[model samples]
Target: MTEDRPSTVGVLLAGGLARRMGGGDKPMKTIGGRTILERVIAQLAPQCDGLILNANGDPARFAVFGLPVVADTVEGFAGPLAGVLTALDWAAEHRPDVEWVLSAATDCPFLPRDLVERLQRARIAEDAQLAVAASGDQTHPVIGLWNVALRSDLRHALVIEDMRKIDRWTARYKLAKVTWPDKPIDPFFNANTVEDVAKAEQLAALDGA
Candidate 1:
């Protein structure tokens, strides 16, 4: 990071079992002639100092993205919270200067370009320890900002308490809710099914993506 912006890193959370979307990396699916992961990277890369992908299984699967892939230290597809913990640990080790990490879902192709800035601004204004993205009535907990300093506490929660729900853990902190409009297409619309991928394709076309 630089002196102008907050020292922050971006983590693409792709550590999920895509049972509904058949079986495979949902992010690898293409929308508008490009992989969803590519769209996520395109939106997030410029907003942070560095970017990494949090996933399990074979790291080679995401090699084309060329970002560091960090697997959950806590075993068993422990959900997005585990992925967040992995990013926190990775930041602590590789990006010690970065105090915050913005985690976004890989399947969300229309992620806003101002995601990091909005989250950071909300956290600062609310004096929050964490900030999550929201649209209309829905809250996307996986797409949030986490404090690197909470890595130790997060690891203990996952390893000791077996904490899997993101909301459950985030409740312990002063959390901020940063919302974006759900018009035309929700910025946080995630591709969890084949139908969603098609819808994303249409949305991508509309955005000239």
Candidate 2:
């Protein structure tokens, strides 16, 4: 991670049960002739100084990505917040110069290329501790920028504060929102099932929005 841009590291949260996908590494599945994880990496790698994958189980399976892998700091699957915690812990300890992390779901191949820049600018403009992307009327808490300084607070919240909801975590800190237009195809589109994978493939092949 480097402060040269927004001092942000890209964290791809791949830790999921993937019940919708009939129990498989959803990120490893195919989309547009490319693995979902590869597509996301190709899209997000340029926007940040470095990137890491957050997932449990054997890290060897994802070694091809060549980024350090971090698992949940807590015992159980505590959801996106846990992934954020893992990423924060990694950033705080390994990449001290990076103050923020830009997170996106491994399933969201269409994430806007300008995500990091837009969210960083939003956080600064709003004097907020976090910035999340929103589309339609839905708020994407997972797709947000987190302040690495919140690791201690986040850990405490997960263990002591009994906070599990992503909305609850964001509420504790100032939050800024970035909106994505409902274009021909949503930039934040995510694939959660086989059908979704097919749709994502069709969308990926489009020549223009």
Candidate 3:
């Protein structure tokens, strides 16, 4: 319950079925000899005090990751905003000291290393309610830092207003975007399909040079 790194819990939204790559967990897919989830968790673990995986059913498959598995509070696949909202609830109950929760999808293995620190800095500097990352003029709403206090408002909006896109809720509150240089044009890349997997492998090889 202290304002320390342990207060923040990194939430991995891993419930997606890789429709583009047939119908299975994309996190389980490999690139450059590591599963996407493995690569992502390695980068994410060092940035937070604790971590949890948000996905539906059969959490045993992800047991090797050694993080708690949570399911959506709402039943109908309401999208990433619902996942974010679920994470807020988890943060509230478990990591009470954490004023914010940092979240991202499992498929974005190349997420920035200083992701949590940068988003926190931006939120404080801009005095905003929400903070998300930007790369090469593209804003990633899923990779975000959210104030835990917004849980009630988000729930009300979802339940009553039937809002879906994260941007719609973000727009209602003050938001700040922290842009990362994409000179190599790689910060926000995601591996969503077999082609993307191949491209990511190639990009990683190039980046290692």
For this target, which candidate reaches the highest lDDT against the unseen true structure?
1
RMSD vs true structure, all candidates: 1.4, 1.8, 2.0
| Candidate 3 lDDT over residue span 1-209, tens digit each | 22322256789998776689887898998878889899889998888888889998799999998999998887787778778889999989988878888889899868888888888777877778888998888899999888899999999888889899888889998898989987684677888889998888888777861
TM-score for all predictions?
0.96, 0.94, 0.94
Once fitted onto the true fold, the runs of candidate 2 whose alpha carbons sit more than 4 angstroms away are: 1-4, 207-209
- Runs of candidate 3 exceeding 4 Å displacement: 1-6
Cα misplacement distance, residue 75 of candidate 1 (Å): 0.5
The lDDT values for all models are: 0.90, 0.87, 0.84
Q: In terms of lDDT, which candidate is stronger, 2 or 3?
A: 2
Return the lDDT, model 1, position 122. 85
lDDT of 3 at 82: 79
What is candidate 1's local distance difference test score? 0.90
List model 1 lDDT by residue over 1-209, tens digit each: 43334878999999999999998999999998889998899998889899999988999989988999988888888898888888998998998888999998988999998888888888888889999999989999989999999999999999999888999999999999988999878999999999999888888889787
Q: Which of the predicted structures, 1 or 2, would earn the higher TM-score when compared with the native?
A: 1
lDDT of 2 by residue, 1-209 (tens): 32224778999999989999999799998876779899889889998889999999999999988988999888788888899999999998999988898888999878888888888888888889889999877788899999998889999999897788998878878899999885787877889999998888888788332
